[model samples]
Target: MTKQHIGILALLVIILPSCSYFDFSPDLRFCDDFYVVVEEMPVLIGGMAELQQKVVYPELARERGIEGRVTVQFIVNKLGDPTEVQMVRGIGGGADQEAVRVVKQAKFEPGKQNGKPVCVQYQLSINFRLEN
Candidate 1:
C-alpha cells in the first residue's frame, strides 16, 4: 500500500459518488406558455350578466358585509372546457368559493390559432357585490 496508491483510492471514492449528484431536471425555459396572438380569444357563453345571475352569493359574505372581486386563472381547453382553475386573488367569507363555483360552471368558446382550437390561458374576475 504505497502513499500514491492510497491517494488515488481516496480520490476515486470522493469523485465517483459526487458525479451522480448532477441531474438535468426538466423545465419550461423554452416553452411558449401563452400565445401572444391568436385568431380568437376564449369567451364565456352568456357573458357577465349570466354569471352574475348564476352566482349564489355566500350567505356568510352577505351577513358579514364581505364583498369584492375574485380573480381566477384557468386554461380553456380546445373543447372550451375550463381546466386548471386556480384562485389568483380571493376574498374571504366564502365569496371566493362562490365565485369559483360559478366560474367553473361556465362554458367558453375556445381560442383558435391558425384556424385550429388551442389551449388558452384566461383570467376572469368576478365581483361579489352585496345588493343594497
Candidate 2:
C-alpha cells in the first residue's frame, strides 16, 4: 500500500475510537458520567426546610448530644430519584446512617444539561441541633 494510504489508516484508527460511534466501548471517558455542574442544578421539591423535617433525629445521637452537621453526596438521576447515596461527612452516633437514609428517600427535579435531564452529583448538608 502507498505511504499516504497507510497514514490515513493510522489516523482513522486514532480518531475513530474517540468518535461517538465507538462510545459503546468500555472506555470510562465515553461513559455518561454524572455531571458535577450543569446548566440547571437539581432542586429539592419542598426546599431544605421540608427535607430537614423529614429527618428523624437518631435517638442514639440525641441521647449522646451528638449535634453537628452531616453532609451527604448522591447522584440525582434523570428520573429525579436519589441514587448512590453516601455520607461525605459525619459525626457518627448513627447520624451518618440517618443522613444517608433521609437523602435516599428524597427526590429532586432532575438537573438539566442543554435543556435535557441528566444525572448530576449533588451534595447537601443537614444540621443537627438540640432544642434549647
lDDT (0 to 1) per candidate: 0.81, 0.87
Give the TM-score (vs. native) of candidate 1.
Answer: 0.71
- Cα lDDT of model 2 by residue, 1-132, tens digit: 999999999999999988987775443212167999999999998899999998888899999999999999988888888888899999988989988998888878889999988889999999898896
| Candidate 1 lDDT over residue span 11-38, tens digit each | 9888876786764443322223556347
Which regions of candidate 1 are displaced past 4 Å? 1-37
Q: Tell me each candidate's TM-score.
A: 0.71, 0.75
**Candidate 2, pairs of clashing residues:** none
Best by lDDT: 2
Best by TM-score: 2
Off by over 4 Å in 2: 1-32
